[model samples]
Target: MAITPPSNRLWWKEPIHGIELGWIVIAFLWGLFMFFFMIAWHFIGEQNLSTETYKVKPERYQERVEAFAAEFQAQDADGQPLEENGVPVVRPPVGGDAYILARLWEFWPILELKKGESYRIHLSSADWQHGFSLQPTNINISVHPGYEHVVTLTPTGTGDFGIVCNEFCGVGHHTMTGRIRVVE
Candidate 1:
């Protein structure tokens, strides 16, 4: 004789059993609710995470220099031709090291800035090509030799911003990294 479990009893084995059907229905509804809730939350939260567009160009720094020189010359008392060394200084709002130069596999000193202050970064490669990428904000800019690239950043929050090289230079390319500390 074969042994039969209590669950195989007539009452429990019936396909129309109210309790079993109720439980199945309840589980299906709960799963549907959870799936919809997750999708709704994702769509709602992603709206607040938009990013601003930034450009990377070889002529940006040169353009900025020319614009500043023109502006200063216009304001000069004698309207003299703009001298390269006499370009008016536009100090970074956060006031740390404003210019940084580095080689293919190295980074200059890290920068620290305050929230809501404008920072002007003048970057140029000493040797080969390199890329400047600021993470969490996802700003990827390129740096090349013989051309200085200018980037302006205003930290919206207080945290550490990572700088990574996205270019494939020679050996030690994986070790190229830097950081920007944003203080409150």
Candidate 2:
């Protein structure tokens, strides 16, 4: 008599049952739905501030910053050139662009904005990496010496917002503070 080998496949390895197959299909479809939903919300449904940014030599970027400061000098309530929190201030006109310099331990030129106006704020580091954190609203932007980081913001509330460097640069890192005032 000839001996035949048993089947190589286990019984459980047979084609999946209809109920199990249906569950797998449903799960796969749900995953696809979630993926597409996230894409739509990020690209369309949110107030994303993806500003137009580009790379430049640090020296070149600094030149632009100096020119911007000379152009939009800010003044205090007394009609004198303003100095907010001990740093120079720049209150650009409505619908205009603004610049802030993040160096070793200071953010040069505090920003003053209209409560309901929008601005294109460009930031760059003159020395090392820094973090631009605006309090109350809790907005953060990365500042690098050779790259320009741009962001758009419209202050809905009138108040003074604090700017802190979240990156550790040196001994005075803890005191690297700046401010922006939103007025009516």
* Best model number under TM-score: 2
lDDT (Cα, 0-100) at 14 in candidate 2 = 77
Alpha-carbon lDDT, every model: 0.63, 0.85
* Model 1 per-residue lDDT tens digits across residues 147-180: 6656666688998777788998888999887766
For residue 23, model 2's alpha carbon misses the true position, in angstroms, by 16
Per-model TM-score, in order, reads 0.49, 0.73
Clashes of each: 0, 0
Error of 2 at 115 (Å): 1.0
